[model samples]
Target: MSDASINASTVTTQTRVNEASFGDYFSLLKPRVMSLVVFTALVGLLAAPVPVHPFVGFCAILFIAIGGGASGALNMWWDADIDKVMKRTKGRPIPSGKVEAGEAMALGLALSGLSVIMLGLATNWFAGAFLGFTIFFYVVVYTMWLKRSTPQNIVIGGAAGAFPPVIGWVAATGSMTLEPWLMFALTFMWTPPHFWALALFMRSDYDDAGVPMLTVTHGRRATRWHILVYTALLALLAVGTAFSGIGGPIYLTVAVVMNALFLRGAWQIARRTEDDSEADNYKVERSFFKLSLLYLFLHFGAILAEALLKPYGLGGWS
Candidate 1:
C-alpha cells in the first residue's frame, strides 16, 4: 500500500480498537477555545463605538468563530504526529483516529473559504480578508512552521488569536483603530504566560514529540522566568488599555487587582526550582494557568459592561 493508504488503514484500525465517538470529530475544532474567540470577537463588534446592524454583527461574529474553528481543525490535522505523542493531546480527533487527517484538512479548508467569503458578503471585504489571514497564519504559519521549528512559536503565532478583535472592529468600521490594537496586544502579551504555564507541567510531552516549546528547548527555569516577564507585561498592557478609552474605572480596578494577583502567582512560579517535585510545583503553575483564562475573559467582559453603561459616558464617546 502507498503511504496514504497505510495511514488510512491505521486510522481505521484505531477507530475499531478505541470505539471513538462523534464528539471526537467535533473536538478537532477546539470548541472551548473557539467559544472564547467568539465571545471576545462579539464584544469587539458590539463595543466598537460605531453601530453595526444586528444581523450583520451576528454574521460577522459567526464567520470569525468559523474561521477560528477552521484554524483549530487544520492545526489538529497537521500536528497529528505530535498530538499522538503528547499526553494532553493524545485523545484529539486526528490522533485518536476518529477523524482522518485528510478529512480534517478538507473541512478546515472548506470552512476557511466559506467563512471568508460569507463574512465579506455579509459585512465587508476588510473583515473577510482579516479572517482569511488569521486562518492562514494559524494553520500554515503557526501550526505547520513555527510550532516545530522555534521556541518563539507562541510569541509570533499569537497574532492569529489576536486578530479577531481587530477583525471585528474592521467589520464595523471598515478600518483599523488603536482600540482594537490594544485588545490585540492584550492577547499577544497574555499568550506566552498562559501557554508557558501549561508547558511547565507538560514539558515531557513536548520533549517526547520533539516539539520545540520553550520548556522543552530551554530549561524550566528560563521558561518560568519568561512566564513571569510576560505576565508582568501583560498586566501593564491590560491596565494601559483602561486609559485608552476602551476601558473605564471598572475595568481599571479589575485590571489592577487581577494583575496584582497574577503577578504574585508568576513570581511564585519563577521562584520555584527544578528540584521540586511535579506534584508540589504544578500547583502554582496550574493555578496560574486557570487564572490566566479568567483574566482575559473578565477583562473583556468588563469592557462590554462599560460599553453598555453608556449613560455615564465612561468609555470615552460622550
Candidate 2:
C-alpha cells in the first residue's frame, strides 16, 4: 500500500482505540475471571487456621482482585491479535476496537505494581510476592509463551490460577501449609478437565485461531479420553481431601456426590462417537462444561462451609 493509505489506516485504528470508554476499559479486566479469583482467594483466607483482621482481610482480597484484573488486562493486550479471529474472543475490548492495545498494557502494568506494593504493605511481603509471581506466570509465561507453544499450556499454566488460594492462606496465617496446597491442587487438577470440556464444544474457535488446545492438537478422541482420565484422578483427590482435616462430613458428602456425577459426565463424553456427538450437537459435552463450573464452585463452597462451621465445633473431621 502507499504511505498515504498506511497513514490513514493507522489513524483510523488509533481513533477507534482512543474512543474507548469506561465500560470498554472495564471489559479489558475480564470481570468473570476476577470473580473466580476473589471467591477462591476468600475461601483460602477464611479457611486458614489463623484469624485475619477484618480490614486487613478485605484489603488483601481487594489487592488480589486487582492483581487478577491486571493479569486479565495484560492477557487481553497480548492476545488481541489472536482474539480478533476467534469467534469466542472476537468481541473483547481490544479485538472489538473499543480499547487500544497500548492502553491495555499500561493499565495492566499500573495495576500489577499497585496491587503488589499495596498487598505487601497491607499484609506481608510473602503474599505480596506470590501475587506478583502469579501475574508474571499468567502474563509472561502462560500468555506469551505456553499458549502458542504447546497444548500443555493450560495444564502447566493452570498454576497461575491455583496460586490464589495459597496466597490467601499465606495472607491469613503469614505462612504456607499442606492444607492450602490441597485447595491449590483442587483447582489445579480440576483445570484440565474443565477446559478440555470447553475445547470439545468450541473446537472450531481454537482451530480458527491456530491455538494449540488439546482438541486441536491431540484430536477430539484423545481429548475426550484425557477428560475422562483427569476427571477420575480429580475424583480420587476430591474425596480424599475429606479425610485431610480441611474437609469434614459436609465436604465429604459433597465430594462423593459431585465427583461421582463429574466422572459420569466424563465417561459419557468419552464414549461418544463424532457422529454420536453431532447427532445432538454436543449436548453431553455442553452439559459437562456447565457442570464443570458448578463442580469447582460447590467444592470450594463446601470447603467454605466447613471452615465457617469450624468455630461452632460443627465443621471438619471430628
Candidate 3:
C-alpha cells in the first residue's frame, strides 16, 4: 500500500478514538448492574459460615466487581451495533459514539485478565477460576451468541450474574458448599422475572434492535405468563432455602413475607393487560419491576442480618 493511503487510514482511526466520551467509558462499567453485584457479593462473603481476613475479603470483592464490569464492557462492545437501534441501549458508549467498539473491547479484555489473576493472588484459585468463567460466559456465550439468537437468553445468561455470591463464598472458604449454591440458585431463579418485566414494557426497543426477546418473539401475553411463573418459582426457591443450612429465623421470616408480596405482585401483572386502558397495564409491569428489585435486596439483607445476629443466637434456625 502507498504510504499516503496508510497514513490516511491511521489518522482516521486516531480521530475516531479521540472523539470518545467519558459517559461512554462509564457505560462500559455497567455501573447500574455493578451496584447489585457488589452488594450481593459482599453479603455472600459476610454470610458465609467461615471467616476471612478483612483485607482479603475486600480485595476479592473489588476484583469480582472489576470482572463483572469487564463483562459488561465486552457485552456492550459486541452488542453495540444492535444497541444503536434499541431504545434502551441507544445511549450506551458504543452506540452513542462516545467510545469506539475496539477501545471498549480492549478495556474489557485488560480488565478480565487483571481481575482474574489478581483475584487468584489475593484470594484463591477457586475464586479466580469462577471469575474467569463468568467473564467468558457473559462475553462469549451470552452476548456473542445467545442474546440475539434466543428468547431464553436471560435464563441461561443469568448464570453469569449468579456466580458473584458463589465467588464470594469461595473467597471466604477457599471452597464451595450447598449454602453458597443455594444463594446462587436464588439469584439465578430471580433473573428471568426481573428482566422479562422490563422486556415486556420495552418491547418496542428490543424489536428495533432485532433482538429475539421472549416478548418480541413469543408475544407479550406469553412473556407475562413466564414472568409470573418465574416469580412464583423464585419465591418458592427463596423461601425453601430457609430450610437449608444457610437460612435462619430472620432470613426465613423475611423470605416468607417478601416472597408472598412478590407472588401477589406477579399475580397482578399476570392478570393485567396492555389492552386495559384504565390504569395503563404497563404500570403493573413497572410496579412488578420495582418490587423485583426489592425482593432480591431484602433477601440478601436477611442473610446478612442472620450472620450478624449469630452471636446472640437470635437469627439462627431454631
Best by lDDT: 2
Q: Which should have the higher lDDT, number 1 or number 2?
A: 2
Residues 120-179, model 2: lDDT tens digits: 999999999999999999999999999999999989999898888898999998898899
Q: Which segments of candidate 3 are over 4 A away from where they belong?
A: 1-18, 21-23, 277-281
TM-score of each: 0.92, 0.94, 0.92
How do the residues 1-318 of candidate 3 rate in per-residue lDDT, one tens digit apiece? Answer: 999999999999977875666765866989989988998899889888888889989999999999999999999889888988988888787886778799999999999999999999998898899899989999999999899899999999999999899999888888888988999999999999999988877758888888889988998888878988998888889989988877888888899998998888788878877775135757877888898898899999988888788867787685
Instruction: Evaluate model 2: give its lDDT.
Output: 0.93
Q: Any idea how many clashes model 3 has? A: 0
Local accuracy of candidate 1 as per-residue lDDT tens digits, 4-35: 99999998887687764677767777999899
Distance from true location, Cα of 291 in model 2, Å: 0.5
Model 3 local distance difference test score: 0.88
Ranking according to lDDT, highest score first: 2, 3, 1
Enumerate residue pairs that collide in model 3: none
Model 2: residues with Cα > 4 Å off, grouped in runs: 1-18
* lDDT by candidate, in order shown: 0.87, 0.93, 0.88
Provide the lowest-lDDT 10-residue window in model 3: 272-281
